[model samples]
Target chain A: MSEKRIEISQLGEFGLIDRINRQFTLKNESSLKGIGDDAAVIQASGDECMLVSTDMLVEGIHFDLSYVPIQHLGYKAVAVNVSDIAAMNGKAEQITVSIALSNRFSVEAVDALYQGIKTACENYNVDLVGGDTTSSAAGLVISITVLGRAPKSKIVYRKGAQVNDIICVTGDLGAAFMGLQVLEREKQVFMADPGMQPSLEKYEYMVGRQLKPEARTDIVFDLEEAGVKPTSMIDVSDGLVSELFHLSRHSEVGIRIYEDKVPIDHMTFETAVEFKLDPITCALNGGEDYELLFTIRQEDQEKIKKHPDIHMIGYVHDRKNERVMITKQGNTVPLRAQGWDHFTE
Target chain B: MSEKRIEISQLGEFGLIDRINRQFTLKNESSLKGIGDDAAVIQASGDECMLVSTDMLVEGIHFDLSYVPIQHLGYKAVAVNVSDIAAMNGKAEQITVSIALSNRFSVEAVDALYQGIKTACENYNVDLVGGDTTSSAAGLVISITVLGRAPKSKIVYRKGAQVNDIICVTGDLGAAFMGLQVLEREKQVFMADPGMQPSLEKYEYMVGRQLKPEARTDIVFDLEEAGVKPTSMIDVSDGLVSELFHLSRHSEVGIRIYEDKVPIDHMTFETAVEFKLDPITCALNGGEDYELLFTIRQEDQEKIKKHPDIHMIGYVHDRKNERVMITKQGNTVPLRAQGWDHFTE
Candidate 1:
């Protein structure tokens, strides 16, 4: 009830998180890991831990209904939460999805949304557990919490990376960002002329990447199969550069990446070129790829080196304050994280 | 893309949940329980199990900011999620809280909200582990997920009631509902004349019940201490009749309650009469009590009969389709559930 009001925009998302988290202290011995990790880890029993993560997606801030299908929205919601668990190298066992919608939606629409949720659950071998269904005053909001399990020794955290470890990434990036651009363009065109058809067939892959991105549970399985455990892991929901910064800050290590080694899909590269955006920049800064980013021990490099989808993009180094990217043109530039800044334009 | 738009209001809240859940099937061996229970139970190691539950509260739909303080809202959000775990006879270990707010809110407001969340966490002996913070276009939204632990043999479910079990509820009912009425009336008076000072000292207890209700975790402890485990259990977020119906339907048993056994505080009863509302109806249909409702075996009844707060309200019977309330005058009437139907007026 103080008369002084300080706007949220003055402090960005990370600043706000730091401010809020500073006030809380963990009280339970079962809480092995708290606010700073991709998912919270709790000790369930001997050598076994349970991981929990929650995410909330608001309508205009997270998605546009005109471009994103309701079913895909549901799928993406569950997938994102699952991705948090996968980042910890755990197998997701269950998920609870809570959604609030306005009267504008229909029963059929809700069914379609749950259909996408069910599909993700089936694909990830997770059970849809309990949830809250309620009405919202405005647009739709979806919140999902995923529960996962892993051996205590196998669980990875953002602060575990050591100097000289090889940094790796899963799948190609920038596609989801390019897909979002295509969807936005189509939406504008449709708004201008309702009769005109959207020319989106050529951008189908990018569009799908934006609409229904999958979590990298497969990568977690592959890593375990190869007998490789990541020293540190994080999911790339906020651009690669942003997540890299997080790993660097949390692990207290420097990160150096070769720009050419960063994987970008051919369609995404072409679309970025057509849109006059730097493909490498798009690859570094495009958010919502739902890909896994991790650092592995120098000794474990050979085990996962030949994996098809696994890309060795960089290495962790001893220089604590420096994070740089070496361009294909032989220029080294300090990497800047332009991740999703919800407060600013 | 279908032209037919069936509004969500036409089906009601429970109808929407039923429609959505019908399509999902559990595929994991670790998933011992799913959508219908208070918390989903996941098989962990030998004897331990993990319980997960989620709840979402939207701005105008669930609370009014004009009368309800943000701190109380934050506390209530955590309390409700913890109540779900208590319903499963489990101890909550950790929680993840996700929030979405518009720019209109200040850093101070966010702090106040988290202060309440931290208070609840400290009081409940749970860890505030992880959460996501984001911006929303409309009003504020809060979604919380709680993780709890219990022995596999001690976990309670909603479908385990026997034919002759005694129905029990903890604490009093209808106070939160009447408390809400008091706040609404005060809000109206204040709106009519801004300079008017509202007099609310006499209704402090009722007001607290509405603003900051506690989950009956103590009852779970007491029951365990008395060597009694509920055959079936559910938290009374929705009214007594609505929760009774849930227990009956899930357990495939009938329920009969006596009017004289229903617990109502004197202030709440008087307030209901003042508003020209039926006291029995308010006790039966009023929501947000956050009390424990469970069924106990007849043999164990003697153990809890002297507990002051535990009310022996009803009994389960063999008739599957019958749910009735016996009046003090000895007339039996069918019980109807009208518990906070969000979709319907």
Candidate 2:
């Protein structure tokens, strides 16, 4: 074999996506948008269109069966896919879930997994459409594709942010990351001493955040009701800083955020300190929070200003590569993203 | 620890699907059909509807990397998903391909896979839409979701076959199964004697059939041109008899076929005989044939009668569960589906 071998780690995930994306050109007129966005937009009706997004969660790579409940895994699978649709400012209506698992999984185990899936379907008002089920060689793999609907007028892309647009994020950040820390710590303790039971009572909030994160679809509805469409939007799945980089690049704008304004739950902050981690760092880099992060036009900021859950953390500016954060002491520091790279890790 | 453990193999794949299907109800108005057809039907526009179908291919469970080229595997993955859309008598326009691979695969391998995916996209005239790329702990897993469009009037389901309807199948069958046999035999031979070079010149047709099965989208075009609508349709992915059983159960009709009329290539027949296997049984129970199987009205038979690739193999009867095949010697035998059950195997 004379072929040159280039390791995938050399390109990394995003670089690899860029390489693949460069090769294909959209041929169908109905395919309004393709690979780059959170969800691909397809023309549906006269003024309405459909949004399609997919996510695959592998067993050992994405979750640990020993610690993560099979049910929560099912629910999280649906939620994360739905979050993609929500990031597009659309309502997810249908999903197809395909699962591949080894024979080690039982019928009762599958039932419990589906139980969580069904619960999520009800909660999100999304219908289960179609999927493939088959056996895997090793552990479980869940891949879900979600379809969403929105009027063409209401659709927002990540490339639409203008100068001086206010950046807003829904709910507190880093709680899910902290929750993961707690779960991992508990698992380690239980593994060290088999007879000692795990005590999760004190970390229930953060633990639940990690186990059963919700897509911020309600925020999409709230913004619509308030007549304030986000200039640009994205779901915070790969850390706040990483997603901000995406918005900045796509929108071709700079970003300025205050570290003091970054939302962090009290429990998350306290736990981060206890774990000898910086709360601000966790809020910026810790991922899987499934929160909506978006930028609104300066004129529309007043519409959602009084909203309890939404926080105004930053603003978009004209300088393209000048992303920075103002510390509590008023020191301007360049913001660097330490996003999760599953491949390299 | 006290929970009852019922193995998944006990229920088989179809039984497990039934159990999962019973627990959910479609609530979205856009969800016209869910979970029961080759593709889920969603109301898109006035009379225009969209079809959604998904399929997942696991490395070891579905294909062996030792013999199968990664590029061909990628093309086969897309083709199978498109075949599902073709089975529904719809034109597939967009697809999302999500792949999970471990570090064992290189950047060059990933590029080869995407190259095949791109070629399929061009061949099918389908747009490459959104998908997830993630790291897996083991072998490669490819999950593809396809979106298609057809007028509601032209859409066909699995439950529309009428009594005495003529069953037509596109292209020849069983070649793919034979191809698998040849590949597996060569693999074993190579394992025993590593220096032996595999000479597959005589088995090219069958080998290609197994490695890169083409979807019968052209047949769908031919049927449209002939102005014929199939009463019920399904893809022959899980053997001809298994698909017949699906149509029978869904349409509440019996199936009767002539074994002599079943199309088998000379190469397939010769190969099956060489392997000491029954050719007719291979045609009956051999899976992975991405051919269209549908029922047409008696009046519409002449429209496609002269089609070179179309074979009139069977007919639908009034009595449910009375499926049988008449052998070349005129002896009737009960038709039973030995469909592929990966879990059980």
- Scored by DockQ, the top model is 2
Which pairs of residues have clashing backbones in candidate 1? none
Error of 2 at B233 (Å): 0.5
lDDT of 1 at A166: 95
Give each model a TM-score: 0.98, 0.99
Q: What's model 2's overall lDDT?
A: 0.94
Instruction: Report the Cα interface RMSD of each model, rounded to 1 decimal.
Output: 1.2, 1.0
Model 2 misses residue B145 by how many Å? 0.7
- Score each candidate by Cα lDDT: 0.92, 0.94
TM-score for chain A, candidates 1 onward in order: 0.98, 0.99
RMSD of each: 1.4, 1.0
Which candidate number has the best lDDT?
Answer: 2
Tens-place lDDT digits, model 2, residues A146-240? 99999988998999999999999999999999999999998899999989898888788899999999999999999999999899999999899
Local error of candidate 2 at B174, Å? 0.6
